[model samples]
Target: MLEEIESSAHSSGVISMDNATRYLRPTGIDPIMGKVLNWLPKLGISIAGSRLLAVRGRKSGQWRTTMVNVLTAADGTRYLVAPRGHTQWVRNLRAAGEGELRLGRRTEHFTATELADADRVPLLRLYLEKWGWEVGRFFDGITKDATDAELAAVAPGFPVFRLA
Candidate 1:
């Protein structure tokens, strides 16, 4: 079943879940853009709530950093959504349960709780509404306006973490 999904994703440019790893392989331009994103935040420039997420590597124990969008809900909950699925950062956050969000010299230390698929719909919707223009491709055509059932169907492939 997972293999079928991955095969479809590979052929259709969607999120892939293969062998319990839900990751859409990055495109050639992704690394280039990542470098730019990583650099911009250090200059105190943020593109739509962009933050440099630094978390300890699950195995290596070294800090691994990546650019992530921080979505704050109306009720003041903050979330981190892995639009490209269960990438290294997601796995690391799962293992370490805490990390830091940085912009320039300001750093916010946070503990994360991974949300269940059933609990991710609203957060995912808000995330897509805010970041879909930048990350819509990875979502298999699902958008913020997508039906709840539609979002729920793909929620398992995209991990959402609540940051405290």
Candidate 2:
């Protein structure tokens, strides 16, 4: 199992990468989709049960909000994943430590703990099993059936946060 990634950014607030260079394409249709989902929760609806995640930005000192999927495994652990990879919300949650998952009037307040790559195998599989239709394209065609080694090889690219 892998233990950690080579990232310079920690919950302690040292960041070496920015939005444009961190992931594949942080500014694209997905951001627009998130904006739409953020509005839906206000109207008491969701697409595939996604929620609006609102957290304080690490730099802006203001609420940075986006839509994210809350993954609940069979073991009952909850998680938030960045399928397109290291997004602003992921960075904010890392710096801020907690956030809220909202749908209309209902909100789930959570403290987030980012999981290291070596520890993400099973959860990655579960997430793909449940949300592949929505996020599979980001995985370079890797699916739930990908082996542990295969998943691990690409795990560093997907930032996962366990919420409590």
Candidate 3:
């Protein structure tokens, strides 16, 4: 009984260590999952996947990178929409009005736009339907069929930057 208990403890310790890597590794997904995420954008897909964006800080003027969801517009332009109302990246873009999106190996310039609420109503509805739970609780009380006035109220906070 004593020998069996010692063996179980040793095996459990190894399992725990292996589990730690699951959280520590950034590309923790298997090759298949990684491939799926990489190809998602090519298929004209918007699968709630985010990429690291490097933008000049508003005050500091230093390079800052943060993960953001990618949203494509009708005119073949890509945008970074901030649904959270107030985030550091949104604030940075509002101040600097320019940034670069780092998607995998490519980086693209983008011009910021603090869209009016009425202007973003349609986009917001699409976001809620497509992004689903990935957008967090930001739009909880905000109705999908919000009026122009309601959209404008929230528009200042949810800025959209067009890729240049």
Candidate 4:
């Protein structure tokens, strides 16, 4: 079944099933920590640049929210990377193409463009460098110190979106 999906994806020039399914490494969610993370942002405190990301669900059309680290490049571009790889938010954002990032009472809505795998290397390195302490475990041992080739090799497994 997965093979059929992969074959169809390749033929259609869409993301492959293997690329979508192979890299999802979900760590157990600590309920206490989850509550804290979600609560802090509502009180106007961001944990190391975390934001409450709210993207509309593709199937349900309901808004789904999660805590995420937003990375800002030196040139001032902002990005969102899925360290867990092709997550639900990634799929939702891919379908909706836009979402909101909430910090306190501020909700900034933006459209996102998914970066090609080739363009993800530097962003991945920068993201790891910034939020690695929190998200590093999801990267399969890849770190900010990884070589460009190493980062590139694992880029497809991670989905990066450039926000505008």
Candidate 5:
């Protein structure tokens, strides 16, 4: 259990990244599910076959981690999307510029480069196609059927990262 620990990096001493329209849904079943998913990687099982992403905290320099669904495109490129709208992990990854994707005993460390909104259409489509049942509500009703324009409209809210 992670108690609220204060860091000197912010005026509030709590790690809250500045964002104009971040959506923080109530933490209910999410924490419990997150704990289970986080533990599964150590046992060689992915919660729904997704990786556990870990990034260094911008403020505390400690590792903050969460279950992330990794998407692989037809061209073999991979992406990480933040469906929760610029959550802590997204902010930390942006700050650290690198992180690890882990499952079981395998850990692949790579640098993360945030993709621009203009380039996120296809990736976002694939993401929604794959995980819509789990994260669609966060997207404000946009689905795989949404045109590029609609996606672009909501693109700025979701942060997509390309790992190399």
Candidate 6:
């Protein structure tokens, strides 16, 4: 199943690896590759917390599980960000506008809201601060203090979800 999705992305000509050099992620923080690399803990520690977000396919209505880095704010808002614009998980969230997240065996429903220009900046900043050093060119020209307009132009497809 995973291979198929990876294959499809390549076949569609939407996959780009040029940005990798500009961004840095500790070894496997790139979701563009696969979840196993980004999630599985090492030495009894996981650098980025992991979560399984389950959402129904927009076209098929079938539920799917995607491993993602979980980000939480001091204000109690939780978001799942896709630095890579061309990810299946991001697509699913957009198509459904709603999904459930699983941490271990616990599940919580969430409303998937596409973060506008105003929201992308902060989210991108958070992502960069956390994994940017590991990712390099992937985030070239992206700064922790980018304005909403800048984010909207650079990360047109990135989305931020609000937990319900």
lDDT score, candidate 3, position 87? 55
lDDT of 2 by residue, 83-115 (tens): 867767778899999998888899888999999
RMSD (CA, Å), candidate 3 to true, equals 12.5
CA-lDDT, candidates in order = 0.88, 0.78, 0.60, 0.85, 0.80, 0.62
Residue 38 of model 3 has an lDDT of 48
* Model 3: per-residue Cα lDDT over 12-49, one tens digit each: 33211121121111223433564666454444343455
Off by over 4 Å in 6: 1-47, 134-137, 145-152
lDDT score, candidate 4: 0.85
| Candidate 6: Cα lDDT at 113 | 71
**Candidate 4, poorest ten consecutive residues by summed lDDT:** 22-31
Clashing pairs in 5: 41-104
Model 4 collision count: 0
Cα error, candidate 1, residue 50 (Å): 0.6
Top-TM-score structure, candidate number: 1
Runs in model 1 deviating more than 4 A are 1-15, 18-20
Better of 3 and 6 by lDDT: 6
- Candidate 3 lDDT score at position 147: 71
Superposition error at 132 for model 2 (Å): 0.7
The residue-by-residue lDDT of candidate 6 on 1-164, one tens digit each, is: 87787576455444653322111232333445555643443222344776666889878889977666777776877777775554666677878888986665466788867666556677777877776765434555676667767765665545556555
Best by lDDT: 1
Error (Å) of candidate 4 at residue 136 is 1.1
How many times do residue backbones clash in model 2? 1
The reply for model 2, stretches above 4 Å from the true place, is 1-22, 26-28
Q: Assess the local accuracy of residue 10 in candidate 1 as a C-alpha lDDT between 0 and 100.
A: 81
CA RMSD per model (angstroms): 2.8, 7.4, 12.5, 6.2, 7.2, 7.6
Q: What number of backbone clashes does candidate 6 have, counting pairs of residues 3 or more apart or in separate chains?
A: 14
